[model samples]
Target: MDDSRAKGPPADADINLTEPAPVEASLTDNPQKLKIAYEQTILYARDLNLKIGELKQAEKALRQNAADLAVLFEASQVFLSQNNIETTLQTACQLIVSRFDLQLSWVGVLTNDENEIHPAAVYPPHDHSDSHPLNQVGASSAAGQELIRQAIHTTQAVASRYSEPEARQAQPAALTDDAYSLAALPLLHNGEVLGVMSVYSRQPDYFTPDRLQILQSFANLTAVALVKARLFERLQLLSQQLVDAQEAERRHIARELHDEIGQTLTAVKINLQAMQRRSGVSDLTASLQESMDIVEQAIQQVRNLSLDLRPSLLDDLGLVATLRWYLDRQARWAGLSTQLTVTPSNLQLPANLETVCFRLVQEALTNALRHAQAQTIQVDLQQHDKELQLVIGDDGLGFEVEPTLKRVAYGKGLGLVGMQERVSLLGGRFELESAPGQGTQIRVFLPVPPALAEDRSA
Candidate 1:
């Protein structure tokens, strides 16, 4: 091949193959310089790595902060809207699991036992079940359980990590480096430790001290809400008792009027009639007849008062019969046409439930007749599934329902509020619908106990 176009290497005759290759003048020529250069490069890499690590930590912190805020905002909204304790706790658990994308979350309350806590609620929103209500704490996740105890005992937040196998095995066993995270936060409020709430995540070290602090804030809110809920429930119970007392008082007064006063008035009227018949003088006869007429009016007034206070039919004849009689009498007095319907006409209910039902209808009718200028009123009652339903309607000049109820709630009027309170105290749902130039309608749904429903059905 031609030398100019050849691709192969030159002939070996011109090269020194046996001799050592020449050294280039560079840092390698001096051990000191080479070491210094290598050290400098290492230093540069170390500094860069440190800065990068710090930035990553800062970014992670910001992301975690945003997540914490989102969780708190959503939970606070629920806390603001719902005042019921069970609802608040249940919703809080759901929010935590949903927000954190957590594996599970559970709430443990102070039980009779001082050494351990009991599960009050769990995540995934169970169907009113106790099976696995404790999620992982009751059975395993030993590290988590200990942390829960420590958090509750100290009223502080305790955190740890656990692997899936460790969690599933649920033994109070040691955990490995690679594991899920668990944070036990105390439900501390008013300087009292009510219980503990624990959350789990697949991401190890997810609940850092700062993250736990944010969760603790939510736990604190949940604790306060629980206290408020407890107080509210107690208040509801007292209010229910108050209503029951009022009903009893009314019954007592009605009985007194019907029995004692009615008899006395009747006796007086009979004596007056006897006196008028036996008297021969015209003046005396006229006087006696007037006295008898007054007695008759007095007797009629007493009877009306007795019925209005508390009708005997309410107790002796059940809710349906009592409602029929009450609606009829009120309709006649107000010159309104009343239509009442009851499925399974002989429907019977518990005494307290019957009283509540009767009172609700009574208030609705009174409001419709006295305020609505309604000429036709309808009352419907029926039992369906696990609840009793009642609907009352009237063709009257209706007013704004919300404003009226708000005013009533603020003590402006009791007509609308009394109806609502009566239903609420019994843990029932009450809704009012009305508008100007439109007739009013009141809908009520009262939960019936399973046992009571069975009895009624039988």
Candidate 2:
């Protein structure tokens, strides 16, 4: 080898600059370096375990949140659809207990006269049995009662444990010894505390802040349902008053047409006949006879007008008689077959119910002739137990019932809508069934109040 070549640096033996560095520790021969790397590895494992634990906790929380939202959504749907107050509150109490898995739940209404709560509904309804301690929820634990009062007074949600000092101070007597914890949320609407919804839990520390928030949402929905129910009740009263006033006006007009115009026309015809008899001249007698004919026609028209407005028979003879007469006459005029069936042959109803039944039939029959184009019509009136039912069926050209009724608001289906409003005002049910090429049938059910039913049976 040349002396100059030996002076050059030797080439590397085991190195690849193109490859990436190894991430795994080599634990080099140096003792200090190995010790430092080992300690760092232990710390990294500890932090990894901590991160895994937090992820599990986050997943559990998300599941609980999802369940709570589902319950709230379902409750909102039910509350909006219900129009009865008692049913709405009862359902709310039932849902809270069943979904949350609690010991007891109840709703109490604070009446205007009483300072304390009056129990309205309870979950695990009282069976009047001694088997279950939770049955007597109306007389709840001391803590539960106190929580309700606090919620009402403060207009806020309250919670307490029976073993707590405050709970013991509320009442020394353990009325709710079975419940370990209690919570109450106020039912508030329009600045008014309507009631309180209370819950009892057998587990300690069960009612957390998140759970209270969910319960408050339920209370808010319940308040909305209460407002809707009261408004519906008021609307019903106003509707009935309107119907009564309209009927009164019709009665007045009918009387004027029949009593005043009818009598005067009859008197004129009588006088004209007398004149014809007294006058012997042919020219004058012929003229008097023609005048008598005109007066008779006028009298007949006046009588028809009075009957159409508000039939006197509806007042004097009752519903059945008026129905029979109207159906018979209308059938003859329209050249169609008609039938009216009265159950028990002596069925009678309250005056308002009677009016509703007759008008319903009248309007239905008119629609059948104008829209259905049917040749035959049938009306059935039956009193079954505490309910009075009327069914009007016709074999005519039929149309979609729902679409036509929906048009009522726009004034196109006033005749059908009028019948529905009349029934609704009385807290009754109305059902209309019709399809193209199918006959139309209208069914109405009016409840006979307990007082009237008793009188009827007697």
Best by TM-score: 2
Instruction: Give lDDT tens digits, candidate 1, residues 1-458.
Output: 23442222243223222222333468577988666555545544555555677679899989879988988888877787676777878888888888778766788778656566777777865444333324444323466678887887788998876666665464223323346677888999887888889887767778877778888998998988888888888999899889889989999999999899999999999988888888999999998888888989999999999988899998888888888888888877888898988976877788999998887887888777678889999999999867999999999998987788779878988776788788888888988889999999889999998997887767
Flag clash pairs in model 1: 140-170
- Model 1 residue runs over 4 Å out of place are 1-60, 111-116, 125-142, 163-178, 455-458
Query: By summed lDDT, which 10 consecutive residues of candidate 2 come out lowest?
Result: 12-21
All candidates: CA RMSD (Å): 11.5, 10.1
The number of the candidate with the highest lDDT is 2
Give the runs in model 2 whose Cα sits over 4 Å from its true position: 1-25, 28-42, 112-119, 127-142, 164-179, 280-287, 409-411, 451-458
| Candidate 2 clash pair list | 141-176, 372-397
| Per-residue lDDT of model 2, residues 1-458, tens digit only | 24542232233332222222333455576777676555555545554555566679899999999998998899888877776777887888888888888766788888887486778877777665544434322246555667777898899888876555544443324354433667888988976898888887766688889888888877877877877877887888888999999899999999999999999999999999988889999999999989989999999999998888899999999999999999999988899899999985888778999889989988998889888889999999988778888999999989886677778767887897799899988878999899999999999999998886787777
Looking at model 1, which ten-residue stretch has the lowest summed lDDT? 11-20
